[model samples]
Target: MTRELTPKGSATRQRIIEGAAAEIREHGVAATTLDDVRTRTGTSKSQLFHYFPGGREELLLAVARYEAGRVLSDQQPQLSRLTSWRAWEEWRDVLIQRYRRQAWDCPLDAVVSQLGRSTPGAQAVLTELLNRWQGEIAAGVRAMQEQGEIDPGLDAGQAAAALLAGIQGGVVIMLSTGRLTHLEAALDVAIQHLRESRDRHPADH
Candidate 1:
């Protein structure tokens, strides 16, 4: 069984994890070591081990989870309140800016790459993130359908899946080419398609 930590102990443990995440971000995961984390967090070997009994791999899993959460958190109120066309546009801008600020080097991608996709916990982290992301997009599509801003006959789930795939593919290209144009284009085109669908089926609205 896992040991329960006092409030102070919990804070310390969180500090260690945050510190380790920063270290990995700066040095890359393959280059970061437990000693580096200990020194950076001002924690001793025992404290580090106490929190991460499974050692580096366990700590890495924790970091992966953290980064995954960060990805969705960064999208914020815009992602959650995508009820109107204006809101969707705002969300699009937010997504573009968020990734642009990363300069094509996504933090979550770094963690997944270092941990390797085949790692036991890594895929779960990715799958959860993608599912939540696609869910939000799907929700936004359904909202527009209900509002009569999109075609009622459209498949919200499939539209969301295609949009999500386009986004990921565009991000991959951005990473490879160091250009945000594809990402921007993908979002604009996807949103435009939904808008055009409404136009195509005016009687359905």
Candidate 2:
């Protein structure tokens, strides 16, 4: 699971994943094909199989993983460097802008649902993504705690888990309704709750 990919191989695989994601986003997963991805990536059949031995299904899973990572990667530095109120404020804006623009695509839901939520690999990919995301949130929590800007009594892990759950729930609702209100509300309320927690112990913070 931890193979070292040569830079070229890594780049090629990324190209394939991005290509596949684009195809799926545009056509839906069931309608997209290996040939579509092949043409999109400019990859020959041999080159594609070389990177994904299990064929189209394997490649689909890979693309799913890539999209999942992207859900977090798009929020970087602001998400990772949450050391102050300013950083969280910036992150809040980024989060709003991200979903506001993508409200129509809902690519993650479109593709992942097509991949079958019951598949073990699919579930694992989602679980891993959530864990990494929560870890990032927890890291931000700890950063504020260490800076004496947040209450040490604040359970960072628990807080992060709850926040992630809220985000996921809000995202699901957004996809179902094609509205950003729930997503915006989730983030705003979550951050306000955290700020309230900090305010409760201002002498400590």
Candidate 3:
């Protein structure tokens, strides 16, 4: 069931989640506790329970959603302003730099993995974030197509999906190897393919 909150209640809930995130970032999800969140956020136990009626799991899910939002936020306005080739290149560098700075430490993933992606709230947050992100990318590709910057024949949906898949795969590899090779290779191949595909259209030159 969805929990409804008043304006003040909503603010308090957000405070707890933000505090929880900070605690998790410092000591990880396994080590963060309800008391820590309460103390950190300056919220009382009753106040905490008022917002998180379902308790720790529910709070973690909310934080999961918040962190998922960050994943996309970190990529903007570069992602949002991809109307030209230069914008795409700039966005690519931003993407690479963001992940490079976050190596070996996916705190959000740590929490979600513990919560189980199969959980309804967790799954919904991820699905929405990914779909929205991919849609933005697809829109950018379409905009470039309309500007005659890329091949009009290019499938925007497929290209965007491929890009998102590559990003996810790259992140997984980075998590496993503590390096950016996978991400760099994925972006390099995808971008190279895009450039080559554009070249294939005679009028694209």
Candidate 4:
């Protein structure tokens, strides 16, 4: 069973996680080690084990959760408010800019790659992140539908799924090729489809 931590213990654990995450971000997972985290966090072997008794895998899982949270947090209030065409455009720009800046390294991707998707902890973290992101996108689509800004008959869930898939593909390509063309195109085309629906349903507006 996990032991409940005092406030000081909680802070210490968080410090280790943050320091480990930073080490992973800079050195890649294979290059990072417990010793590295220990040095970076100014913690001893006993202290590290105190919080993460399961050892490296457990600590890695913790870092994976942290990085996944960062992915959504980075998108911020923009992602939360995709209610209008203007708002969607702003969200899209934020997505593009955020990924572009992160082109040097994507911490979540690195951690997931290290842990392997089949790992239960990694899969759970990814599933939660994607589901939450898709849910927000669906909510935005529904808002647009309610506003009569798009086809009322359109499936918000399906549209959001496709858009999200396109985005993931575009990011993968961008990461591989060091170019943002695919990402921009995917977002542009997805948004264009919504705008076209709006045009077709102008009478509904």
Candidate 5:
């Protein structure tokens, strides 16, 4: 069983994780060492071990979680308030701008790759991130439905899932090709589809 950390201990642990993420971001995950993290965070070896007893892999997982949180947090208030067409457009623009700024460097992907995508820890982090993201999108869909802006009979969960898949695909392509066209198209098409559903089911609204 894991021991619970005190407030200060939690802060120290978070500092170490943030430092490690920065190190990975600067030097790439393969080149970052525990010592690099320690030096960056001003943490002693024993202190590092106290918080991450599993050593490097454990610290990497913590960083992975941090990066995962950043993925959603970066989207900000727009992501949470997708109740209207304008809000959705703003959210879409924010997401695109985030990736455009990131370009090819994806810190979360790097850490996950280093940790082995098949590993339980990495898989759990990814699954949780995707589930949370999809849930938010589904909530947005339901909100539109309530406002009579979307078809009442449409499956919000399924629609969200498809849209999320498209976004993921576009991200992968952007990472490979350094182009935002696919991602933009995916967001635009998905939102357009949602709007068109209103036209198709006007009577239901």
Candidate 6:
């Protein structure tokens, strides 16, 4: 079983994770070393081991989880407040701008790729992130349904899943081709479909 960390220990571990993430971002995951992370975080070798006894692989997984959280957190208040059409548009724009700014250098992708996606640890981290993301989007769709802005008959979870898949596909394409068009189209078309659903059930409204 894993031992629970005290507040200070937890803070130190998070600091190390953040510092390591920064080092990986600046130096690339393959080039980064535990010593580099130690220097960046101002932690001793023993101290580092105390937090991550599994060593580099363990630290990398922790960093992967942190970066995954960032993927959603980056969208912020807009992502959480998707109750209005305007709010959804804002969220979409934020998501687009985020990827546009990051371009090909995605920290989450880098870490996960380095960790090997098929690895159980990496798969768990990604699976959790996607599930959380889909849940939030489904909640937003249900909000629209409650407001009579979406077709009540439509399956919100399925719609959200489709949108999430499109977003992932768009991101992959953008990463490979360095073009944001696909991502933009994905977001626009998904949102358009949701909006058009209202027209499909005019009598229900």
RMSD of each: 1.8, 1.9, 1.6, 1.5, 0.9, 0.9
* Tens digit per residue, CA lDDT, model 5, 30-123: 9999999999999999999999999999999999999999999998898889999999999999999999999998999999999999999999
For model 6 the local lDDT of residue 145 reads 92
Instruction: Between candidates 1 and 4, name the one with more favorable lDDT.
Output: 4
With a 3 Å backbone cut-off (N, CA, C), the pairs that clash in candidate 4 are none
Best by lDDT: 5
Candidate 2 lDDT at 201 equals 80
List candidate 6 segments past 4 Å from native. Answer: 203-205
lDDT of 3: 0.87
Model 1, 52-151: lDDT tens per residue? 9989988888888888888888898899888999999999999999888888587678878877988768999889989999999999999888888999
Candidate 5 lDDT (Cα, whole model)?
Answer: 0.95
Q: Which ten residues in a row have the lowest lDDT in candidate 4?
A: 196-205
| Model 5 bad stretches (over 4 Å) | 203-205
The digit string of per-residue lDDT tens for model 3 on 45-152 reads 998988888899988988888999899999999899879878888888999999999999887788889799798877898899899999989998888877776788
Residue 87 CA displacement from its true place in model 5, Å:
0.3
Candidate 2 lDDT, 1-205, residue by residue in tens: 5668999999999899999998998888888999999998899999999898888888888988989888888898788888888898899889878888888676766667777987887898899999999998899888888877777789999999998988888778877898888778888888888878767886342
lDDT score, candidate 1, position 171:
89
